[model samples]
Structure formats: structure tokens, C-alpha cells
Target chain A: MKTLVSYDIVEDKVRRKVFEACKDYGLTNVQYSLFFGDMTHNRREELFQRLRRIIGRQEGKVLICPVCDKDLRLSKAIEVSAGMPEEAAEAAVSYPGRSRKKARAG
Target chain B: MKTLVSYDIVEDKVRRKVFEACKDYGLTNVQYSLFFGDMTHNRREELFQRLRRIIGRQEGKVLICPVCDKDLRLSKAIEVSAGMPEEAAEAAVSYPGRSRKKARAG
Candidate 1:
């Protein structure tokens, strides 16, 4: 899993301390305010704990996003609408009708 | 799922046409390049098909991201490192070792 961690520190010293703590855990730096690499599930648990301690009460934030290279395919209907498939009468009704009748008053 | 549809058109006419086509399918516009609202699985399928037809060969991009309110929690070890739990000596060894013994070459 690829995780994105972002942080903002008030004092420059605190940021350095955070990086030192992360380096101690062997998490490779990826981008500005982001870290990429690997570790066992157990190690990750330990690392997170250590990180929380290092941050203390300073304002910080983190976002972990999963990365995938899958390419989504359009369905047959999609292809047809794109002019590759024959148009069928049934496909017309699939569109939602606008301006439905208002609810009857008691 | 919140779908983001971003398109770049060479001519203003093409951009207007795309919007007209989207409005025909009942997709409510959200941001400058985003659309959000309740859409049935089947409707989504039909919409994608029509969209392909409208765009033809124009350069465009779309990203569909699932929206949720779930908040991720740090594990117990993470809490401990934060100073909320007792420290275990075994946890000290969880950090990844930086240096390893060189492999002996025959």
C-alpha cells in the first residue's frame, strides 16, 4: 500500500526531529512532505506510535492513498453510444424523465 | 461515488455541446470540472456511453473518487509512541535495520 503523509510544523527544529524519527524507522522519503517505502505490519504499528509521540501537540495532518494502475474500460452500451453499437429503442427509456408529477395534495 | 469530469476543448462550441449533452442525462454540475449527485448504477453505465459519443476524439479527463466519512485511527503501538501507553522493550527491535552483514562471495 502507498501512503501519503503530510505535515506542517511551527518550529524548524520540530520538523527536523520528525524526519530524524522517521529515518530511525527506515521509511524512505518520496516527495516534499511525503514518504514512500515498506515495512512489516508490526513495524508499521510501532512506527505510527513513535510518530504520534514525535509530533506531540503541534498541528499536523496525514493522508494515505492507495495507488493502482488499472485502466477502466467502457461498457458495450457506452461503445454503442459512441457510434460503435446499434441503437435500440429500449435504450431511449433509460434516460431519466425530467419534471415528474408533483405529489397529490391531501 | 463522486465523479470529476474535466475537459479541455479547442472551441467554445465544443465545450457548450458537452454541457448540453451532460444536462440531457441529468448529471448535476458541482464544481468547475466536477459533477455530484445520486446516480443509479445503470444510469451511470448509460451516461458513460453517451459521454463517449459527445467527446468523440477531444482530449478530456475524468476521475471518479468514492466519498466517505470514515476516519483512520493510529494503532496501539502508535498511541504508545505518542506517550499514551506503556513502552515494551520488544517494540524497540521493530524498527528496520539499516545495515546488514555483507554476503560472502565464494
Candidate 2:
């Protein structure tokens, strides 16, 4: 099944350990504290136990959710990555006020 | 369809606007930067456009994902909330070292 793991951890050290655990399972990091990947049922359970032990007695909440096929089909993604070098060049080219500002500076 | 929206926004003001927008759409906050809920296709599209405009030209990346049913059924959630008052009392009761430290202080 395709699994989605998300967590809220209070301690910095413990949180980092949890993050590393997710990565070790080959899950793709989707957001700051969210990861997505496919794992068998047995593996998922094993991971659950490992994560539980890692967060023992700490203020943390970890959720590992299995997503459905219909929902996956109906889902969508939107990404806006700003400040790329190419985009920066394009932005510089589009701005007409740059030369004016430079002339004033000189 | 159930939608899962996750974002990485660099600006505080812009990020907050995006966060508020997600909640406005009635999506439940799942993590620090992730939200989940069910919405129609048209509505998801609408949110996409709104989010794009909100993050316009800013250093941001937003993803809206659709999950499947089988995955959801197979998923698991683990929560470890530490430092609750009841747990604190339990810890104090269990740890004999705490009293030793107190005695040393005296």
C-alpha cells in the first residue's frame, strides 16, 4: 500500500531522529514533516513499532496513513518554485525600472 | 475526492495567507505545512488558482494530492503525546532518582 507518514514532534533531537527514520524507509519527503511511499503491510507495522520506540515518553504525534486508489486518482498537485536562476534572469529582463534605478544611482 | 495539500512558503505573510486559505476551504490541518480534506474537482482547481496567485513570484511550492481507498484502509497512525499532567505524575512516581536528586539538594 502507498503510505503517508506525518509527524509533530516537540524536541529537536527527537524530531530529527524521526525524520531520519522516515528517510531510512525510502519514503519520499513531500513536505517539512510529511513523507510518502509504498510499503507492504508487515513493513508498515514494523515501522510503526520502531517509530513508537523512538518517540517514547516524548511530546510527539506520528501518523502513518495508507491512501486509497480512488482518492489517488482524484488528487492533484501544484508547485511554484521561485528564485531559480533562469527565473531570476527572466525577472531581470522583464523589469523596465532597473535601468532607471541604475542611472539614478550613477 | 480527498485532497492533501502541502506547501513550502518562504515569506511569513504570504505563507500565512496560504495557510488561512486552506483552512477556509475546510481542510483539516494534518501537520505544520500539510492539510487534508475532501473536495470536488472544481473546488480543488479553484483552490489551486487561489494558492498560485497568493504565492505569486514568491519562493513557494504547493502540492495537492489525491489518495486511493486501498491505501487509506491499509494505513496506520501512531501518536505519542508526552508531558501530559497524568503522565508527569506517573513519571515522578516511577523515577526513584528524582527523590535522590531532591535529597542531594537538601
Candidate 3:
């Protein structure tokens, strides 16, 4: 299934762990706290379980959603970084940790 | 079409204006910088143009995407505020600006 995971984590450390978990699951980091990609039902469940454990007693929320191709086609993404000086800044803004990287599955 | 809009604006003022525009378009505040709801192609284009103009000469990025019912069903939202005191805090974190009121949508 094509899943979209988004979260609002308070603690910086906790948030980092969540990001790592998403990355480990082969999900693409689309935004600061938003991840997107495909995952098997078992993988999604495993991720949810891990995220639940990781988020224990933390003041935060993690949302995992699905995205079909039909809706995704209608999707729009607008990125404006023309004001930045270096090309790296735009890449950094667009993809948080994968700047200058070739690409990953999304 | 079912549309999803997300933005990362630099200036607080410009960000607020963009938020107002999204709210004016009847989009639901699903996250801090994400909005979701149904909108015509024309409306989406209009929003894109307005956001583009608002973010001119500024460091920001606004993305508008689509979400269909099939994908929406597989979505999961988990909120952890059991340790927090007062109901308003949860409301504030989950849905900013629209606290203690009936929800517009998801």
C-alpha cells in the first residue's frame, strides 16, 4: 500500500527517532515530519507498532495514511527557493536529510 | 477533487496570510502547515497563484496535492495527549485556532 505518515512530535530527540524509523522502513521523507512511500501491510503494521512504542508517554501524534495513484496524480507540489543563494539550500529545504543525494524511492 | 495543501513559509506574517487563504478556501487544518479538503481545479489554480504571489521574493514552499476516498480510508491518525492537563492544550496542538468549536473537517 502507498502510505503517508505525518507526525507532530514535541521532543527533538523523540522526533529524530521517529524520523529514523520512517527512513528504516524505506519510506521517503517528503517533509520535516511527513513521510511517503509504499509498504506491505505487514511492514506498515510493524512500523505502527514501532512508532507506538517509540512514542510512549510522549506528547505527540503520528498519523499514517494511504495514497492511491488516482488521487496522487491530481496532487500538486509547489516549491519556491529562488531567493536562496546556493543550490544546496533549495535541496535541503525540499528534502531534509537527503540533500545532494541522487534520490530515493517515493 | 480532493486536495491536500502543505507549505513551509519563512516569514510569520506571510505564513499567517497563507493560512488565512487556505482557511478561506474552506480547507481543513489537518496539521500545522497542512490543509485537506475538496476543491475544484480552478480553485486549486487560484490558490497556487495567490500563494505564489504571496511568497514572492521570500524563502518558502507551498504544495497542493490530491487525496481520494480510497486512500483516505487507509489513513491513520494517532494522538497522544493523555499526560497533558486541560483539554484545550490537546485541542490547540491538534487543531490550532479552532479550539472549543465544532470541527470543520479532516
lDDT string, candidate 1, A56-76, tens digits:
554333233222212111111
Question: In candidate 3, which residue ranges exceed 4 Å CA deviation?
Answer: A82-106, B82-106
| Clashes within 3 Å, all models in order | 3, 18, 2
- Candidate 1 per-residue C-alpha lDDT over B1-106 given as tens digits, one digit per residue, 9 for 90 to 100: 3222323334466557766765675666532333434455566666665665555554333233222222112212111122322333223222111112221110
lDDT of 3 by residue, B36-94 (tens): 78899899888977776777667777767666665555555556775755443333222
| Pairs with steric clashes in candidate 3 | A75-B66, A76-B65
Best by TM-score: 3
Per-residue alpha-carbon lDDT of candidate 3 for residues A1-106, written as tens digits (9 for 90 to 100): 6677888788889999999999999998866678889988788778977887787777778767666766655555546664564443333222222323332221
Query: How far in Å is the alpha carbon of A95 misplaced in model 2?
Result: 32
Model 3 residue B65 lDDT score: 66
Give per-residue lDDT, candidate 1, residue A53. Answer: 64
User: Lowest lDDT 10-mer window, candidate 1 chain B?
Assistant: B97-106
Position A26, candidate 3: lDDT: 95
DockQ of each: 0.05, 0.33, 0.40
Query: In candidate 1, which residue ranges exceed 4 Å CA deviation?
Result: A64-106, B1-106
Q: Against the unseen true structure, what C-alpha lDDT does each candidate score?
A: 0.39, 0.66, 0.69
